[model samples]
Target: MSENDIERLQEVLRDFAKERDWEQFHSPKNLIMALMGEVGELSEIFQWLTDSEASHLEGKVKNRAREEIADVLLYLLRLSDVLDIDLIEAAHDKLEVNRQKYPVAVFKGSSAKYNEIKD
Candidate 1:
């Protein structure tokens, strides 16, 4: 997604919380906890499923997963807004860091941690 999408989401979330006077409870810590709960709910959707099953979720299961994922993202965006973080810039910076840590030649086809990968 583009930066505009993130900005729009942030604006929507900000207005949503403000509309209900829920901004008082949307502190960074509270938002983080809520985000974690949504992530757990998302994980529950895939629990006990095989890799293929997880990848090929159907019907109600997929719908539930989608809702849970959206919850996670909404909370994350709200938290970022509260903390004045630019999520897009942060993601780009993190990707650059990961690229340096996980060079293609050394990390290709491997799932090991960067430090564990030998040159």
Candidate 2:
């Protein structure tokens, strides 16, 4: 919800890794690979769903989706911690760049890539 929330989650993840002696294996490359795996698992859940079906997930499907999302976030947070990157600030910075690249007046309701948006 806030930067403090991200920090708290990062602390919990740090302790979790330390307790398990997993810090040795938590390199950026390994964490990014694990994060990608979790993302693939999450993608699999939606692979067969129609647009409408995907929008309204529920029951076991939703539970599994949540678990996969948690896995992805944990790995991502762990990776960011190891790299000393502020994930929230990085996200905010990226969003600002995107806003400039895709100004609403020219991009609203359009899904074109920034470079492809014509005058």
As a TM-score, model 1 comes out at 0.97
Model 2 is weakest, by summed lDDT over 10 consecutive residues, at: 110-119
Give the Å error, residue 104, model 2.
0.7
On residues 1-119, what C-alpha lDDT tens digit does candidate 2 reach at each position?
Answer: 79999999999999999999999999999999999999999999999999999999999999999999999988988999999999989999999999999999999999899999767
| Candidate 1 local lDDT, 21-61, one digit each (tens) | 99999988999999999999999999999999999999999
- The whole-model C-alpha lDDT of candidate 1 against the native structure comes to 0.93
List CA RMSD, all candidates.
0.9, 0.7
Q: Show how many residue pairs clash in every candidate, following the order shown.
A: 0, 0
Model 1: residue 95 alpha-carbon error in angstroms: 0.3
State model 2's lDDT.
Answer: 0.95
